[model samples]
Target: MFLTNTLIVLATVAGMEAFAWLAHKYVMHGWGWGWHASHHAPRSGWFEANDLYALVFAALAIVLIALGTSGRWPLQWIGAGMTLYGALYFVAHDGLVHQRWPWRWVPRSGYLKRLYQAHRLHHAVHGREGCVSFGFLWAPSPTRLRAQLQAAQAQRRAQPRQAPPQRPPQADTRGR
Candidate 1:
């Protein structure tokens, strides 16, 4: 039973990648852009409003741990998984890719390189919209993502353009 619980925790950690992907796409880029924008845009300082999302997730994990200790639910494992995943994300994203810290190592391996490039593609977008590679821990090959972005741009460009609204002719007031 203990092993089963551990398995569940591990599974939850893996699943958090997908959960993060969706949340980054919909919530962070959509409704939560007010905070998340600070991340995509140029840096003004060492921190960003986007860091609030981390705090929110940490608070949730604390709540879950408290409940689990109180015997209210089996949420401790889930919370632990989320915390571990968050740490991994911070290392990969903040430390390696974005270089928010002093860590300067670059990825030479295949998967790590893909992860790094995919994130570069994500930041290639000018704003929250029309962005790709939402998942921090996982992403498609950079070539594939680039093709998708190009395809989307082509589709938008191929669409018919709307004509400008015509203004009514003004009266000949100068003659009067």
Candidate 2:
């Protein structure tokens, strides 16, 4: 029973992870670009709009859990899988990959380096090269990822920064 449960959970997680990647590549970066823009903008904040994607996933988990608990085995497994995916994403993307929190050491592997490079490229200049690397936790090649990063950096350097708009001063109502 334990092994069966584990398999179900693993399969669910893998499927959800794939869906998450697709959503990011298409929805978030494509039609939803306006909502995702704050993530690419330079700002002084601890969190970015990219974080909202996690919330959406969490809400999905809640709905899945509801369906699963209501006598639906498939839905339950799907929920379990989504939760696992979210956990893995938090570890791999936020913890290990981005190092949002400090860790004493990180493992040096070609695979991990590749994932890092690919994600860095995604953040590079926001949407120049599409579909080179899309996985959240794993990457197949570091060399290709590095090339993508270099290209993104070059593209960013070639672009000029835009100035912010100034607002007109208003009358002081406090004096009245």
Say which candidate scores most in lDDT: 1
The lDDT for every candidate, in the order shown, is: 0.88, 0.73
Residue 176, model 1: Cα distance from true site in angstroms: 15
Superposed by TM-score, candidate 1 places the C-alpha of residue 158 at a distance from the truth, in angstroms, of: 1.9
lDDT of 1 by residue, 95-121 (tens): 889989965888988888899999999
True lDDT of residue 79, candidate 2: 80
Clashing pairs in 1: none
> Candidate 2: misplaced stretches above 4 Å?
102-106, 127-131, 147-176
Displacement of residue 148 (Cα, Å) in model 1 is: 0.5
Best-fitting candidate, measured by TM-score?
Answer: 1
| lDDT of predicted model 1 | 0.88
Clash number for candidate 2: 0
Candidate 1's clash total is: 0
